[model samples]
Target: MQRIISFLCISIFLISCNKEKTDGFLINGNLDNVKNNSLVQLFRAEGRQTVIIDSTRINEKTFTLKGKIENPDMYFLTIEGIKGSLPLIVENETIDLTVYTDSIFASNIKGGKENNYFNDYQEFIKKIRTRSNHLTEEFKLAQQKQDTSKISSLRKEYEVMMEENDANDLNFMTKNNDAVLSGLILERALSTNKLEFTKIKEIYANFDEVVKNTRAGKVIAEYITANANTAIGSVAPNFSGPNPEGKTIALNDIKGKITIIDFWAAWCGPCRKENPNVVKVYEKYHSKGLEIIGVSLDGTPQQKDAKQAWKDAIEKDKLTWHHVSNLQYFNDPIAKQFNINSIPATYLIDAEGKIIAKNLRGAALENKIAELLN
Candidate 1:
């Protein structure tokens, strides 16, 4: 159960398509059960960012918020009273959101395309549950019979079903959708909700032109273009900043060498923990022209504590490489340009300044460098 919850959490992060809406849905609940001073938040997605548009409270177990939103995206009906939330897709139509402690129910307060979407989503859920059960049964049978060949065959069959499921889902959104923004929104929502980031990337890669040619094509096009440009295999965007010694150094200046750009912070425990593997790689590959560039997202350089934390880490880990920092934290120009919101993000750029691979660590990191440098 814990593993399942963890997987769901990962999927939620991957597929969160909270889009900003001009209007919010109507929420109905028993407020007496909720603790005082608790708040409920409404969320939406704008381009690559998720925005919280409105928040309200429940009085005596009943409260309603009414507003219209511009774009369609995922909305959550959250209760500060409890730890769980309900996933909602808010559109131009009015919706009646019903909530409980652990489960939620919603209805179309206003009818039309939005209503159809909810109905379709319900069906999608049903199908997914059925498919998941079927896969579980097949796996159990294969294991009980000790049939290795059958297990492989069952796995292939399960994969084919998942593809069919994706196709069915896409068809549902494209067929009935008249609004250009609607399709893009649906695609983003489903991709995120279904934990299908790879599919999201593929959609941007293959159907970019189609998305562009559509009514809201420009908005969708810009998003896809920006994402694809920063994706693996493209040239890493160039920038320059002051190194630890307060000297100017630029990515372009390091041309004709394999460069690993690591966006990290001293406060980020994962980044500090991963430093040893990075040191090992640097020591092994430095002779072969491998360069490690550390971009720190610590606060102001005036904050001696933050700066010293990094300095101490370097000394302890023996991370002898090219380290630099603007000391702007997430607001650092390079991080913003790269759209990096999380720490411990990594990129491996080739001699030509083109990004080759990314987010490698441990054995995978070692194997990749060994393959390329050796």
Candidate 2:
């Protein structure tokens, strides 16, 4: 069973041929158990940012919110004290909801294209989660009973389930190419190393012009462009940043026959933990035409002395290699160019500057270097 649970919503964009309505959406909600005077809020999520769009207090076990949105996007409906937030796409239309306080996600939502998609996705996830939950129980029993055959069988079953889940996600993204939700899905796929650039580019190419014009579409379009240069088989994008001494270092200047571009920061726990492994790799391989550039994302508004922290970490960790940082945290130009949202990220390139691999760590990082240089 796939352990990841991603909520999805799909809706057909409803357009009126005769009259265009500038008026916004009306949400009519009913609380099943009658919790009166409680606050309800709506939040709009764009990329990693979120803002509340509308909010109201329930009266007589009911509530209403009216608002207009420039584009259709994902929105979360939360009632004060509700255990879970109800996710539904919000568009410029009348939306109806029957909230089940005990099971918020099970609440019926309809009346808009966004609601249609939300319900469809809910039904789809219901089946997937049900089977996955059952598998979890059986696997637990197998482990307790020391049933080796059953354990292996369940592992295989889980792997198959994961593949199917991935395929289903891709299918939805492909079939709903014209909807803003498709762009959102594609944007998520772009964030990870799961799909290759070719696949991503292919999907982006198929999106309708209208989809491309939406906010989500524009964001994904930017992601696609940034990833193209860093994707395996493409040349690594060269970047420059200020070293600890106020001197500058550029990727093209120090890139050896084999190179590793390591993005990390001092505040990052995982990055610090992985530092020793990276140090080990560098020590063993530096003499054999392997080089690494440590790009420190250390400067945040909260840090008292970002530069001192960067220098201190290099010395404390014994990171003896080319290191540079704009001290701009994740906003570092190099980090932005590479679309790096997480730390301990890396890219391995050959002498010609073509990216050969990415995000390798520990023994895998060493093994890949050995394969090329040794």
TM-score per candidate, in order? Answer: 0.59, 0.77
Give candidate 2's total backbone clashes.
Answer: 2
Top-lDDT candidate index: 2
Question: Per-residue error at 354 for model 2, in Å?
Answer: 4.9
Count backbone clashes in candidate 1.
16
- Tens-digit per-residue lDDT, 254-309, candidate 1: 65468899888877889989988988988898899898888888874355686677
True lDDT of residue 189, candidate 2: 71
For candidate 2, the per-residue lDDT at 155 reads 90
* Candidate 1 TM-score versus the reference: 0.59
The 10 consecutive residues of candidate 2 with the worst lDDT sum are: 10-19
**Model 2 spans with C-alpha error above 4 angstroms:** 6-22, 45-50, 191-194, 232-235, 238-259, 267-270, 280-292, 297-312, 320-333, 341-343, 348-357, 360-374
| Number of the top TM-score candidate | 2
* lDDT computed for candidate 1: 0.63
Candidate 2 residue-wise lDDT, 89-118, digit = tens: 666767667888887867776554444444
